[model samples]
Every structure is written in C-alpha cells, then in structure tokens.
Target: MGTTLHPLNPSDANLIQARLSELGYYRYQPEGIWGLVSRSALQDFKAANGLSADDVWDGSVEASLRQARPTPASDTPFGEWSVVGFACSAEMNPRKMVVSAKGIVVGSMICDMQGPLARSSADWSGSVLCHIDGRDIASKISLRVSGQRLVDRSVIGTSTIVPTSFDRCS
Candidate 1:
C-alpha cells in the first residue's frame, strides 16, 4: 500500500487562505477549506513564486507563506511614547522594558509586561505562553506598535491584568 495524502486542517487551511489573500493570490473568504478555490490560489502563488505548481500544501508552500508574513520587530516599536494609563483590578507596580532590534537597543519605558514578550505577525496580535517565577502562564497580548499608536494587554504578577495604549511622544 502507498502512503495516503490528507487534507489540510481547518486552522492550517485558514492560515493559508489568509496569507494567500494578503499576497493577492486568493480573493475569497477564508472559510478554512482546501477546496478548488484554495487549490487554484495555491497554484497561482506557486507559479508566481517560481515554485512547482503542485497545488498542494507542502513544505515549500508553507515556507513561502512564512516569508510573506514576518513577525513584528522591536525596532518597529521604537520611539518616545506617552503611556495612556493601564487598567487592572489587582495591585502591581509598573516595571521597565527595553525594546531592541537586530542587536541594537531602541527604547526603554516603565511598563508592566504582565507576561514575557512574544513576537507575532506584522499584524501584532496573538497568544503566547510565558513563564514567570517558575510558573507557566498563558496570556493573550495584542501589540500593534509598528504604527504610531501602540496597544497592549497583559497580566502582571499573579492576578493583575493591564490594558495599555501608547502614542508617539512628540
């Protein structure tokens, strides 16, 4: 018997669809299905990227997708910032954080991480697993600092959750 090929999962399919859409390869809603529309889009992407037109979600396709969507970097968030105040129900003091990029330090500020820093897509929204004081914590932090406005949500210490927005300090 020969090995069988399985269809992409809904989540993976959605991711591919979204990336394709962003790259102008797909023009349909991301319904998380590897149907004809998705296959055609994938083929187009492969042809455009000079890859084999297999119309399959292979390693090469995934790599191309990743290359198209890079993570947001610290340099993208560099600049003097005005804190918009944080809202939390628990007691916790603000701590300092340093943003850096490509081994160069960018900026530092007094802010609560509430969790460890993580890099998501250029869109800057996702969930990350953090470990604090030997304890594992899962938090959802949305950071969109590439633009003039920066927004963040995180949990500090044990129970303090803070949502903060910052604007460029002129």
Candidate 2:
C-alpha cells in the first residue's frame, strides 16, 4: 500500500483516528490515512493489547474494530448535526442511476417543511433534494449521511428515508 497505510473503509479511519486521540495520542490527525501518528498510536495500542506491536490491525485489529464500533449495526438517527447523501438506482443495473443527491444539509428547526419542500424557496430546506433524478421510478435507493462531515457515515435504511425531508425542517 506504498507508504500510504489504509483502513478497511475510509469511514473507519476517522473512527480510528478519533479513538486514538481520545486515548491521549496527541498527534493523531483524523485525515483518513494511517500515517506516522497513526502508526505510533497503533503500535502503542498493540503493545497495550498484548499483540506483536507491529502496528497492524491483524486479528486483534479486527476484534478492536468490532469492539470500537458504537453499535452492532448502523442505525443512528439522522441528526441535524450531519450532511446527507441520497441516490437512486436500478437493482438490475447498478450503473444506471435515476436520481442522485449530495451535500444536502438538514433543515433548520425554524423553517417549515412545506417551505423547503416547495421548489421556489431560496433557503436550503427544499433546495437540497430538489435535483432528484427520477421522481417516478421505483428503484433501489442508496442513501447515507455523515454525522461529522463524513467521519461517521450513517447509512440510511429503507425505513428511514422519509417521503420528504421537508417535514423534518421544523
């Protein structure tokens, strides 16, 4: 992997970095790369965990990842604290997407859903999801939101996708 160390998923790196910082490793930056600071922290963690101190996640790493995760499955609510990513695609053809949305923020509490849901509002409420690709098509939807600027991805499930986020505006 060159000098560029990697995490299982890009999202995990942020978690790992955050965890390291919490453990008092002052230099750990949440930049999503297993660099020197990360490596040093990993080494220290390995030693503490009674592993080889090789600075690799190996079996111990896997176990640590599992234990470090906040939940068994990702079911966190979409708080106003994060950004949202929404997209729709056909199951039969993953490449053929009908709708896509990115960088949408949750509506503030003061705004009404209808005001945001309506197409004419200049505010971020309705403007976020206004560019939906295919409104009428029944497709496999892939929706995700990041609570801390993609540091933690909150995968949106079918039950969570509201008819309109506008309702959530207020």
Residue 86's lDDT in candidate 1: 33
* Estimated TM-score for each candidate: 0.36, 0.32
After TM-score superposition, the amount by which residue 97's alpha carbon in candidate 1 deviates from its true location, in angstroms, is: 54
- Candidate 1 lDDT tens digits, 128-161: 4455555656545455664556665544335545
In model 2, residue pairs whose N, Cα or C atoms come closer than 3 Å (at least 3 residues apart or on different chains), thus clashing, are 113-166, 116-126
Q: Which candidate gets the maximum TM-score versus the true structure?
A: 1
Residue 6, candidate 2: alpha-carbon lDDT: 46
Give the residue spans of candidate 2 off by over 4 A: 1-9, 65-170
Taking the tens digit of each residue's C-alpha lDDT, what string does model 2 give over 1-170?
32232465567677777776654432446877666656656654543333454566665564653454422111211222212333222133322221111222222212111111111112112222221332322222223322222222112322334433211110
lDDT of 1: 0.49
Q: Candidate 1: lDDT of 115? A: 28
Candidate 1 worst ten-residue window by lDDT? 100-109
